[model samples]
Target: MKGRCDKKAHLTGYKAGDKLWVTDPTAAAGETLQWTKQPVPEYRADHPSSPPFLRYGHTATEYAGAAYIFGGRNEASVCNRLYRYDPYVDKWSRIAHGGMIPNARDGHAATRHGHCLYVHGGYDNDMEEFSRDLFRYDFREGVWHACALCDRWEGMHRDFHALSTVGDKLYLFGGKSDELEPYYSNRPVYDNHLYVYDPAAERWDRREAKGEAPGGRRSHSAFVIDGKLYTFGGLNCLAGEHYNTVHRYDPAANRWRLLRPHGRPPPVRRRAVACVHNGKAYIFGGTSPLIGSPMPAKSPAEEEDEPPLVDHSDLHVLEILHMAWAACGLPVPRHDGLETRPLLPRPTVGRRRPPARPKVRREVDHLRRSQSIFVRQRYGAQRPPLSDRHQ
Candidate 1:
């Protein structure tokens, strides 16, 4: 959907497991967030019966036709159930579940390459303990098994490290390391270390770096495009600030370079999810520090200027080739690569029915409540009376 340019972020909307794309709400009709002429659909679970919900301690990775979410802490407790979302059906299915199930934890890392999903360290319920044991999930056989941790990284079990796959190997860089001894603090820090896991050899190799790498940090997001790893936005350990800088790592050269991101860089935010589709990177649903002190008024002043709105729903996209970073954004000197295409599609299922308005829930009226109460909860609260708000 086109939106006003004044808004700084783009966000996605989800209904019944279907995710829809829209321009930044804060952008002007033609100026601000400009969505593609087409919208892409994200995968949904096999079962659509469950109300849409967000849970913690879960790890999700996108593959051919499904997004797999497994082993996360929900409102209830740490769960081992495995759920797969199908973009075609717009539903979720709980499939086979058996792996070297690690202890229940959150903020872990999941990266898929070839056929296996590599699971890494994360925090436990207490938020004190961190796990380092590595697990592998085989998609072909639907089995989870533990793999050996690098002898070099044997001591500390950390979570929230930047996880990205380059070529057939997986690279994990910088995150909060777990404390193994009582004398040390189990706090998150900016780790400068980089480790590579070779699935073929089933071993971790510490890369020999010749240049600067992204500083030690956590909750940052990273994804691979055309064999290079691109990362941006994450929380650093400090009074509280989100990063806006972008960086790329080349597995071939064993080096890193900061890049100037394309589109409007998303506001400095942390703990957001980002994905690569059709050679572009899309990020959404993150929290950032407010730019100024919040006005104390209970509500907006009807007579004064309108206050800006904020939510964790802003969506941002980076056409990787359009991004102008040094050593980035250039056409290949050769033409041997595969033709690019979008990984997902726009959803067609679960269409929205026009609001059965004229029915209001005002304390003084009852006939205006003909539609389901839940629908009102979802869209009615923000609009004025139906007559005036309808477009």
Candidate 2:
């Protein structure tokens, strides 16, 4: 008797307990310090059990080695359904969660802590109001619970913000809100204030950080790595400006440092998803205004004249440990003695703004000067002068 054989048995997706390796195709031979896209299971158009539909403003959190995706909106309507993606099996299953599910929302923020996932702040189109309510989903119980706060957080209601978990606490960062100013106005207001929520205490505290923070933004991505928090790529809807800048926040010192990582970075976008794994941060998928075209206008008449936005499908990665090493005055490995190159500032667009260097560019220049002074103090005797070395 002959045994049955399978030709595609070796391609069983990723192994359950095996380590994953990411390679950079653009890097020179033997150089792996660059951004590269990782392979994902393809979903055919005819496949019945495909991944979630294309949407923006959804929240994805990793739990139990699987990614849980919740509420987001498409062109037609918003969603409150929950879906889970299993990488090992390369499958997406819609989770039928129990208990009181929150209303359909988009622009919300979610983060995992312990066995529960915390979700907060989104806009509900049906109600036409932004949510300040916080909800928690217990993975063990498979239920959702509404978390009640001790104090009334009237001003904390917002959407397009970022929430990150760091050392038993959740940090909420900049987002666009209409509740603060202009009296129930349609225009969104952007802010850079940092707020911290302690699950143990069940309360929130506002953090006044030192150094220049990133500009007020919405729809940005935030990640907590090694006790520090980093934010990237958000938009200022009020000014019609998008950002590809990166900022690092040290909770121990309560300071913010704008990071100008060496090499090319991602384009200006918002509503991107970012995650940190094994000393690297991976960012994927966001939308940006078309180059040389006007942004979405505020007025109804002008809004119709704006061009369609460009949706990104690219992946970029940042070397977090190398950046930290550079911050600590250590030379980057495998690059000889070459210094990290500065990121060129992006040109401002849209019709509402005058031609001028934005505040972020000025701050980056200031940080560069400060870093130069620090290098002089620490390694002036061992190394040649900056001008001499460059020449």
Candidate 3:
């Protein structure tokens, strides 16, 4: 795709895998979007389906023409099942991978580096503890393994953070940490620091990033496009506010810029899944801050922490070429606790037929030609499996 993926945030459409949508070039001709979800086949016994409960902190990444879903929580408990969805065949399969499968958990970040899926840092609901360990799942060979980190966790453990791959290094940012504080509080501790992991070296370096940095946030979304890293919409534990601001990072130069786009931006949301397709940034269903909720109290005496959440199934698309927000003509989905973050890169596959509208494709193509795009930059070697050492 000529369009870059550096743009952040997403679109409205399928909230819980029901609707498939694209922007309405017509609306943006002065517009936003008109979207529709594709029909998913009925559930199968041999194969796994996108279950309603196992979505919290789970991720979906596109690889080798298929989208894979990894570890997340169901209502009753966390699961380790790995499911794959094929757009071309309209089918789902439960891939059986052998080796040291990571413990089932939620709020973990999964990223594709080479042929393996790297899962790190999540809350082990069963153990009632947080995990900062890294595990590797090799798709081609169907094996789960471990990585050689600097230490047990290599650093601290966090959940609801964002992980994006730039070349071979993985950039992990933000998330809620329980390690901080005086306890007896319901609120979370948020992290703003950035950590870069190099697979070849099997080490992580905490970079002291300079320039305009994004404030501490968790459950945010990020993607690297055109060699720049972009972030948007995360929860601020201290401020007690979900963010709407967008920031861009130039890794090579180590700088940050606040992105100011024109037109309507999506309302403040958290846990929204973000991805780059063609050239636009897609934001799917997420939890929006409850309107008319009481403000957080300033002290322990008048403590207030609960933020009522609203169901959000709308799909919103951002035109990366222009930094403007638009819409897709799909009804906002109605679902509570829709876990919609990508643990994998979202490809331009599985998208239903675009609405027969004029100027949409043409305009997008024009922008593609005019602006730079984010093409995949392969970095680092494939993570070695545990068997390598014994061999």
lDDT of 2 by residue, 158-264 (tens): 77788888889888898766533211233456668788889887888888899979988887888877899999898775566789898999989999999988877
lDDT of each: 0.53, 0.60, 0.59
Clash number for each model: 28, 0, 34
> Considering summed lDDT, which 10 consecutive residues are worst modelled in model 1?
382-391
User: In model 3, which regions exceed 4 Å deviation?
Assistant: 1-34, 39-54, 150-155, 180-187, 297-305, 334-391
Per-candidate TM vs. native? 0.64, 0.67, 0.72
Best by lDDT: 2
Poorly placed runs, candidate 1 (over 4 Å):
1-53, 125-128, 179-186, 293-311, 324-391
Candidate 1 per-residue C-alpha lDDT over 163-201 given as tens digits, one digit per residue, 9 for 90 to 100? 677888888876665233101132334566778888889
State the lDDT of candidate 3 residue by residue for 1-391, as single tens digits: 0012122121222224433233333454424444434454554435455422323457766677666777664333456678776655656678877888776766788788899888887765433345677888888889998876524232266677877788888888887664322111233566677888898888887777888889988877887778788998977656767777789888898887889989888888776667676566776656665667643634323233344556555567777898888755545433332224322212212213323221111112344322212211122112111111000
Which residue pairs show collisions in model 2?
none
Supply the global lDDT for candidate 3: 0.59
lDDT of 1: 0.53
Task: Report the alpha-carbon TM-score of model 1 versus the true structure.
Answer: 0.64
lDDT of 2: 0.60
Residue 134 lDDT, candidate 2, scale 0-100: 80
